[model samples]
Target: MTQAPDKLVQSPVVPHIVTELPGPKARAHLEFDKLWTSPSVPRAYPVVPVRGEGCTIEDIDGNLFLDFNAGIAVTSTGHCNPKVVAAIQDQAGKLIHYSADFYIPLYAEMCAELSRIAPMKEKCRAFLGNSGTEAVEGAIKLARFATKRQNIVAFLGAFHGRTYGSVSLTASKAKYHAGFGPLLPGIYHAPFGHVADLKWFDEVLFKHLVPADEVAAIIVEPIQGEGGYLVPEDGFLQGLRKICDDNGILLISDEVQAGAGRTGKMWSIQNWDVEPDIIATAKGIASGMPLGAFIARESLMTKWGPGAHGTTYGGNPLACAAAIETIKQLEGGLMANATARGNQLMTGLREIQKKHPGLVKDVRGIGLMIGVEFDSHEHAAAVEWASFQRGVLALEAGMTVVRISPPLVITEAEAATGLRLFGEAVAEVAAKG
Candidate 1:
């Protein structure tokens, strides 16, 4: 395991801000971006970060803020963690990229490690990818190839990915599908976290719309990501497990946003005590390096013929090396810290909710993957902007939810500081009411 990093300092010794948010440099960059970049990409705030360390980020304009978004919860070990950076640097010196189809010691080594920590009791095989969406796309192909089936079941409000196959399974928002039409067929959607919906599918949808025998897999996010940081009630995932088992359908857990020790456990599905047949992981997998992988039971994956699914840069040695160190950090201390700080953060947010009942309607999630729901999307969005102005960074989830997923290595003091800023943001929004 990687050694524990020095506890991060929450108090910024450098003045966090001396200019308006998105001061000159950020505005200038935004203008340049508008001229060259795709307008489809959304921007929540104008803060343009040029450097980051631990939980703090310094924007191009020299504005510093505590980053709760964690690059959309991608950096598990904090920005530029010494250990991860060291590993990446060491690997880059030796090798930068080798097609994943060919043998690489690090690639095999990392896959072995994944099996060691996988939720399944059976041995697991893995495929590497460059992002969560690619991981989901891989899962789709593997599921069908193994099952000899065509249809897939997905949950409403889930965001698997934006790729064609993965996006076809995505139901988070219509905007993701507005322009892209005629998505992959043979995919079905159901209500998330609602056990009754599964029953309805088994009884009604299965009997009328799609046959159980033809369903290849049921892909779900153990904890919904872009949909909302919605943690399902106890037994919800287990029920799906049972349903899949009874029908001979594989269960694919989209751990992209909820795994890699973010949920106080190795995988959020572990919290449910049910082993999915396939597990898709990314986000915090490699401490911000573009890496993702889907692990599945050896029994199921071995059936995939040679050269059935391949990627050129999926298992770049540098990413694998960084991932090795990331896993070490997560297991060594960050996982435990996530549990402690998540509770601390959640408790504090609940208290804030108590103080602003009308504005903060709900506080829910597990470990560091938390969400605060307001009565309206406007209030939730307003709170996000307000938090930015107060020197804290967060993201909006769904229509009326605020997401709070900081790095796993976040300190108690940092949690306190961010929550305090969050409460202030809530108060400001409440004041508007």
Candidate 2:
């Protein structure tokens, strides 16, 4: 067992349940929510998470769930991390809001810190934004402006963001782009990893689809998060890097779900030696606060003038404070913890796969960013629902993949608990089949 740092704050006594989920109280709360909230974005889990600490979520109905989803991988430091909470509370008293034009100490420090710790630190400068979409938008703008080209290349099974500029670059599914019209022009799609033929990427994607002169940039995710935590082939990223370099196209890595110590490393690309020109990060940047950043070398970043881009609430003091402390905590041992925990999880899943071969086809991932691929979407949904019933909270990725990204601050014991519950759910579902 890996011992926790002495300074680490202890979690509260966990709650337990004696009744079914959504037991009366949660159902009533849902009724209230249905009246006030938009109908389009429906809630999945019946219980409303009221409070969270360490690796567990306590619901309004007093049911506790081992948090495997980690607020969709945003709260990597665990829920209400003490250092981050203290930073937020302290900053809230002094300053909460600031105009983008104003020179804020926290903002400057955050930018500096991100640049210092980023995988491509030697060639990075930070552009702070309010969300992942904003970071993607900034990357697109920078790529287009710097390269002086309009053609942008994205991979298949990619989910950049929901905004217009970012959405134009996303190629995962139709629904995300169905209703939207007149997306930014000259965007092209290429197959992700050349799964069928390894050489196809070099022969087709790089040489044919996106030719050198006309191409502006190639954007990719280190590990496809929303697209199913897909880890590309060994040399795929290095191949992309070479292609981008040969074509004078900038490579922008969308680490929105895989960065800020999610993949046991500060950045997922660290797993591969490939260095991208620009990197967009969010989700876990401020340990769940709305903070996004696009980083590039100072030379490439200088393409934008004063009025090139701006946002009303970008790099607010509260988020900056949270991010600063969050980064500080990640430096010591939390990142290594994620690596160790992830190995344990991957190994455990492999053992489960051997026991229930038909249910889980493949278990693949790095660090805590992992996915178990089921045979079909229906089976995946069944497993997810079963896990929910078993008091484990996990998320589905793509159509047939279950993502197991817990908070980095999760203990080895909590991981073992979640995995055991998940395995039980899988066994029950597989037996039915």
Candidate 3:
């Protein structure tokens, strides 16, 4: 039998189910969705969630789900956390929006807070934006402006974002590129995390596409999100740093998914003891509010003057307020809990894989950003459906991997409980196959 630890706080309200998932109300609403939106728009396992608090979400049917995905690892403070809610509410009353051209208090506070926790505080500066894509866009622009080079190198099976510039660096799937003709010129793709890939960067990169003279930057995720949670081999980070230094190329670590305390550290790159010249962050930065930013060294950032980049809601007051509270909560015990819970979850997942070798091919990740890849994407999807039926909500990353990122606030026992349900889901899939 799988282990099911009682870890969740007994919500002041327990979950209730008035009907089956995607009950009449949801299906009815979806009819409107299908009519107005493109069919390709995602609606897998469709369920309209009515409410959320802590690590759980309640569907319109009233079925409560243990949210293992955490809106793809946003909501780090947990769904509608009281503190975050209060912060948003308080700020909404005072000021909801602001112009980037004008100064704002929350803006200054967030920038200061980000600079403080960021690696190499004395050398870093930040540019705020509204999403992960914008952060990557800013980082790419900075790389070019500072170095005055053309080619940017990304990795295989990587996901930057869907925006044109970010999408060029993203190589995980063909669909992201479909219908988007002729992406930005001079971007190159490299294999990430392998020694061969590293060697290629040192040797072939200069000799081949857009030589070192033309190379502006090499961007990578220290921990690849949406790429099966592939961790870099030891020495990879330092090796890349040396390569960039030798080539005079800016190293941009796209920590959009892996940063902001999700990886048991303020930045995932911290685990490797190497520094990135530019770091992009989002996802959990504002506990689900729309926000993203890139931090650059003082010297590199100074290349752009006034009005080089701008966004209407980039550093809006409401999101900044949410970010302030999110950062405050992440400090002190919350980051420690993420570290402890990650260890517990990894240990339990390994044990489950050992017992059910036919089901789980590999379990890997750093901190809460975990993935369990199956033999096929079909198999992974089956497991996902089974998990949902069993009252746990999860998501898929890449083709054949089940992403297990939960709220960082998750307790050790809570992590274990979610893993148990996942193990059972995989076992059920294996049996059916």
Q: lDDT of each structure?
A: 0.89, 0.84, 0.83
> Which regions of candidate 1 are displaced past 4 Å?
1-15
Candidate 1, position 236, lDDT: 87
Cα displacement (Å) at residue 414, model 1: 0.7
Q: Taking the tens digit of each residue's C-alpha lDDT, what string does model 1 give over 159-188?
A: 998889999999999999998999999998
Candidates 2 and 3 compared: the better one by lDDT is 2
- As a TM-score, model 2 comes out at 0.94
Which candidate number would show the highest lDDT if scored against the true structure?
1
Query: If scored against the real structure, what TM-score would every candidate get?
Result: 0.96, 0.94, 0.94
Ranking of all predicted structures according to TM-score, beginning with the best and ending with the worst:
1, 3, 2
The candidate, 1 or 2, that scores higher on TM-score is 1
Give the alpha carbon lDDT tens digit for every residue of 351-417 in model 2: 8899988889999999999999998998999999899888788989998999999999988788887
Best by TM-score: 1
Q: Once superposed on the true structure, which residue ranges of model 2 sit more than 4 Å away at CA?
A: 1-15, 121-123, 195-210
RMSD of 3: 4.5
